[model samples]
Target: MYSLTNNQLYSMPKAVRIFASSALSLGLTASLIFYPSASQAGKNDTGVPAELQGEWRYGRISSIQYQDSYTGQSAAPNGSSDQFQLASNGNYKRNRLLQINTYNCASNLFIEEKGKVKIEAQRLTFQPSDSTSKGQICNSGRTYSSRNTAKPETYQWSIETNEYGQQVLVLETADGKGKAHYGRPQ
Candidate 1:
């Protein structure tokens, strides 16, 4: 009833050592081939990557050159929150809320879009079947549901893992003007 210690195993013959190392390597390679990580779980029914088939909330934005303001109040206090819901069936819904605060007034805008999304190469094209937008400018109030006649919006996209190990979806404008970062709603 003898047990081989690590020292005894290391002092074994060269042939035995090589064989043991090869066996260990083969086991690791086989495990990797059989068990994939969550991200590598394969595509959804709509062909969306497994990592991108979920709800993501707006996190931040950065322009290619400078910080561009959507409300013209670049230095003023502003807040925005958006959500992108991607279904495995190729359907998606986006809800966005933007508020702008100026020295004299504040404006708010909200937009909701529902559509089918397609991913090709590194681009994601959203063809909205329906859309609704409502906003208020200072004091004036307006509510409207208009058909989106604009062409399908497409963006270069990728999922990046931050230092904190959180998945962030980076969507760059088709024109390469800016990138919007989104993450899971905490």
Candidate 2:
């Protein structure tokens, strides 16, 4: 058994120290060169998750209209334009459904029309509550009404990336169906 003295135990040869330092420095350089950090991976050019579960600010409302060929009547096609303000804090709200802090609306009228909304991967679905038809009149001179008549409609939404890497959500739905164009507030 060869026992080293106290001084020798704590001391390393000059050559060994130099070799270790060089190896460490080389490893660090290699890591930085080959494996860039997440922040350095092109300016964090990412987009909102497929699931729109966070808060979104209200943007615009574009009414979609169409002609009912059968009745030759101009009908207010089922469609709506809305915005969303998403927060990293995991809180989310839809402009067409509820008025959030970032939304500017006199009343929650849109909510009454669209009802509750939920976003799934690349799709948004909502249903208008029966209460929305409170004073709505039908063509028969009777009050328009519904008992859970509002059914859930789904829309396929996508995120578009431009040259600047900014993102925009493109929403499309069937004609005479739910609203169109849902995106972040301008």
- Clashes in each model (backbone N, CA, C under 3 Å)? 0, 15
The residue ranges of model 2 lying beyond 4 angstroms of the native Cα positions read: 1-51, 56-124, 127-131, 134-147, 162-166, 174-179
Among the numbered candidates, top TM-score falls to 1
Instruction: Report RMSD (Å) for each prediction in the order shown.
Output: 23.8, 28.7
Provide the global lDDT of candidate 1 against the true structure: 0.58
What tens digits encode model 1's per-residue C-alpha lDDT throughout 1-186? 001134433654443334333322211000111122235346876778777788988732222122335655344355566687989898999876655544544455566789999987678887778776555554444332334522367788777766676767777766554556677888
Least accurate stretch of 10 residues (summed lDDT) in model 2?
26-35
Candidate 2 residues 5-109, lDDT tens each?
A: 223223434432332223222110001111211222221123334334343332432243455656666544332234444433323333333111111111112
Residue 31 in candidate 1, Cα distance off native in Å: 34
- Candidate-wise lDDT, in order: 0.58, 0.34
Model 1 residue 4 CA deviation in Å: 69
